[model samples]
Target chain A: MLKKERQALIIKQINLHNKVLSSDLSLTLNVSEDTVRRDLHELAQENKIIKVHGGALSKSYNVTSQQSDTYAYEEKNIIALKTISLIKEGMTILTSGGTTMRAIARALPSNLKATFITMSPLIALELIEHPNLEVILLGGKLSNDSKISVGGEVVNRINEIKADLCILGINGLDFDGITDSDWEIVQVKKAIINASRVVIASTISEKLNSALRLKVCNLKEVDYLITELPSDSPTLLAFKEKVNHIL
Target chain B: MLKKERQALIIKQINLHNKVLSSDLSLTLNVSEDTVRRDLHELAQENKIIKVHGGALSKSYNVTSQQSDTYAYEEKNIIALKTISLIKEGMTILTSGGTTMRAIARALPSNLKATFITMSPLIALELIEHPNLEVILLGGKLSNDSKISVGGEVVNRINEIKADLCILGINGLDFDGITDSDWEIVQVKKAIINASRVVIASTISEKLNSALRLKVCNLKEVDYLITELPSDSPTLLAFKEKVNHIL
Candidate 1:
């Protein structure tokens, strides 16, 4: 089989069985253990799976398949509250689409007079109820899974706007930058980075060391990284040392 | 063959031949001339073909299988101009996804100050260049075919917002109300209607008297219906008598 096909099969196997050993993958694909480990590492970088001492595990399977509404509601709500606290009236902000961003949208004070620009349909609906806020939607090819805009057209649009702040949701983050598994999403995130003056990323602790196939930006691109955990947490500290700020 | 399928086949033949007499199609499809004329008339109602003297000719063959970006451009532009004229500085507007609405977005003046809420990625991008406008996008299931947001989540979000104006794109407009071909789209339109104080519909003359599978709202639901043709046109007169203001 082609390498792409083999890698697809490996991902499928891991998805089905919840884990896969190097030995099993090597034998199944007629490759060496070293090769299998390399494949596992690549997939790990994509944040598609977690590489353990022996094998790989699914990365927060609960949120991977369901809508953002089904994911960690409490943690997302907390992060959202914290993110919204940074906003002042009459500011322009850019945001991505996800449960986390949706939470932040819901958390916005109804009386705040900020102008919000985003690619999430859910956020647009939320902003309409807020009489004081103005909402702008970015247009592009819509992803069936994320229900957000992601494509060349969206990227082009993002280049035209300059926002005071950008609230981002990361699937994974590390010394390298915020990462996502989908290629099209990577393009969208890049656009978000270019449009915003200050970049604030919200992610959980487990995603610290993880990487994904698409790199949205490097550590320098983000001005602040927000998490539900305290600043003293080991993982949070580790991430802070690699990046600029931890909130 | 089923009636719809047979009609589709007759339409295809007419498209291929450019013009087909009733007797000609009746011979080819092995149907009576009466049935042939009926099929032609039905397709004509959909604006899929145009009946001529003693025969029928295909509507401009520009509409391909893939999505056509060319639907009602001049008319849509006029409607867009009228729609954008309704927006005052600092007003919040709700918009649905379609080529017509996208045109309205493109027509927005750079100096115009407002907040735009929509489910279309393209509209969001267009609004970005207007420094005075804010954009908000609604998140939901994305339909690849239309490149727009749809589904229950989008509907729920629309329920949460109340906007000053709602600009809608229509597949067809009959005496009963605005109509769409897709059931999910109709659902989203319903939500948009409930969330906005005033509803303005931008449709072309061809959409008059046409009915799709999904119904959006009754004629009273929309405050203004804008079309390309003159208000004195026979079709427009017929429509105005049944509906509200026709622009």
Candidate 2:
């Protein structure tokens, strides 16, 4: 099996049982114990799972096989709640793909009337319960790891869309600006950023001040910043100087 | 709690524990047993769960709380397996959304290289693990129950997309035509039929000949038909004259 598939299977197993034994995963996946351990270690590094001796436990209380989220999924969930409060009825939103974004999708009020133009298929599914919410999936080439449509088609499609607000999930954000590890995703983010009136970048405080391969935009380009941290915290204070708003 | 929210919670609880009692759900949700029983009854009507006296069991084995798809989920799964065999690597496919399509999405080979243009947000999530597959979600108004896109945007998008093949999930298919209960979905499927080089329809044999609200297209419009029934069985032989291909 491919490494991605194996990791996904491991995460699914953890979500189903809330914990997994390395030996069991090795047997079920038909892979080496060392491979299972390595996968566990990598997931731990991503903060997606808690590494335990001989096994791993889910990072959150109840993972629904959605690969949960990053570094304190519950904390990000709180931030997601705040993000939804910013949404006014009948507004158009441009949402980028990630676990944090999916949380926002989950927390959206079912009765709220809104239009969401999103690049993430996963976020679209998360938002499916809303009867009044209109979802426009920005179509294009798909990126393997990120699971978002990327590249030229997405960029071109975004050019034709103008949403009231844009909520982006970032890998890294620093003084240098918002950066992503993949160029294709960075291009698509640029389009999403360009198409919206208000662009808010959301992530856990743990990811702040980090830089990656390609820059999506400068901090000045981001209208607002959101994290689990208090808005007035020193962590956000640095970002407040670079951006117009923080939440 | 809203009826939808109540239903979602019941589904989640059922997924967490293989079975859940109505009394326990009434206690947990702070609703009356009557309300809980009503919710359970509604879900059971949607074919979402197996309703037993006093409680409910999961509709299928190991439902991941992604609303595990359709009546006779296992029977649809058999047809889904055969659908995958028709797909060639690197083909661009136009797919209509439903439980059967989701089963096909789940059964897809991880190594297969293909692009799927679909209207279902749920199906997109189901297809996310295929590293080589490109998923383009047709966006528009979200239908409350079906969870697929509809209206002008999806119709217009389909017009521009000429896929190599189109696979449609139907409410009913008989000599009259492939039918659906939703007018908006029928409009979108009409556009899909116009844009595809080859059009195929799949359903469980139990749903055959049960026509609903709208007529999507004539049986002559379908290039292939797939059912759980044996191709040479007396049951499937009825559809042989109308559809060119069967599996």
Candidate 3:
């Protein structure tokens, strides 16, 4: 099994029993004890679990809980909160998978009706709780870390879809260009941008001046920028000239 | 034995008996006491269980807050359990949308690698949890009650592929024929039956000798009929004569 698959199962087991032994996980996942231990260690680093001696215990809330349990960072929460206002009822959306996008999924009202097309399996699960919403999960080879779909199949599927807006997550952004580290992610993001009428980049201000190896798009391509900082913040002045709207 | 398997056993033992010794595990799993001790130590770190003097304590292990709301009817559970034997590791199965099919989706092993074609959006979400399972959701106009897809698009999609088995959930069944209440449902069920080699009808024994307004298929066409009652029961004898197999 893939590492992401193993990790997802581990998270599921921990949430159910609230505690899991490394030995038990090894047995259930049909993996080596050492691999289970490494998974526990990584989850611990992500603040999703606390590594104990014989087994691991889940964090305060289940990892699967939509909004409250995960994405508690101050700035990400601020960006997530502001992005909700941009999405109106009955709009079709294309969302890339990331922590910030997850926040938006959690904050969505249960009664709201909308169509959401996403490549991330984890994000699809998070958004599946909305009773009135329609969730379309694009299938392809699953990426281990980002937990999103990548490769040619995903791009082909996205090409056939056109949405009202695309909510994108970025690795870094600057006057030079918006960038992401992973090549496959850059490809998928580019398709998402093309499939939607408008592109909204969801990010914190800390990523403003940094640049990654791959250029995703130019600054002028972004229709709206949602951030925690006020629209009039001096830090956003340079961003304003390149984007149509900043919130 | 893998360390994770050993650790899982230890946790299970503790849950069942309230405590377990490291020496006992080493003897049972053919591992060293030091390894068992290390496992216990790690589980303790996560607060999943308490590393006691010789073994471990339950340590909030019984708190099953993470459990999804399932396991409602004993009859449904029995049918779901029996259906597992029919599925192979890599077989593609077409699952009809309903409560009983959801149970089968929930019971699928995490390691089982198979393609599941489901028309229900809700079942798609449930089956998506299995890491190795490839879910092909047949999207079309949604039915409010069953939450499965209906109409021309769904029929067109199912016509293009053949599956090893089709797990059908019925509203009613009788010696005369299998039936459903909705016209669209009957149409979809007919297409699903045509798209698979094997047809397995899952129902409570109470639904026997009952007929709804619309006909799905004849009793002679059913490959398997699964219910809560024993196969030898006179209640199922009539069904046995028509179906290819029963359990």
> iRMS of every model, one decimal?
16.5, 10.8, 7.5
For B1-247, candidate 1 gives per-residue lDDT tens digits of: 6788888887778668666777777787788888888888777655567665566766643222222345456777887887777788988899988788878888888889888888765566566657676776665445534556677767887898889999998888788777776777778889999999999888777777887656788998888888877667787786666666777
- On DockQ, the leading prediction is 2
DockQ score for model 1:
0.02
TM-score of 1: 0.48
Q: What overall lDDT goes with each candidate model?
A: 0.75, 0.81, 0.80
lDDT of 2 by residue, B115-157 (tens): 9988877777677666578878665656767778788877888
Clashes of each: 25, 0, 24
In candidate 1 chain A, where is summed lDDT lowest over 10 consecutive residues? A1-10
The C-alpha local distance difference test score for the whole of candidate 2 amounts to: 0.81
> Which regions of candidate 3 are displaced past 4 Å?
A1-69, A73-77, A97-99, A109-157, A169-188, A204-216, A229-242, B1-69, B73-75, B125-131, B141-145, B149-151, B181-185, B206-213
- Best TM-score among the predictions, by candidate number: 2
The top-ranked prediction according to lDDT is 2
Q: Residue-wise lDDT of candidate 1 within A144-214, one digit each (tens)?
A: 46667677767877898899999888898887778899888888888888888899998766677898887
Clashes of 1: 25
lDDT, model 3, position A202: 88
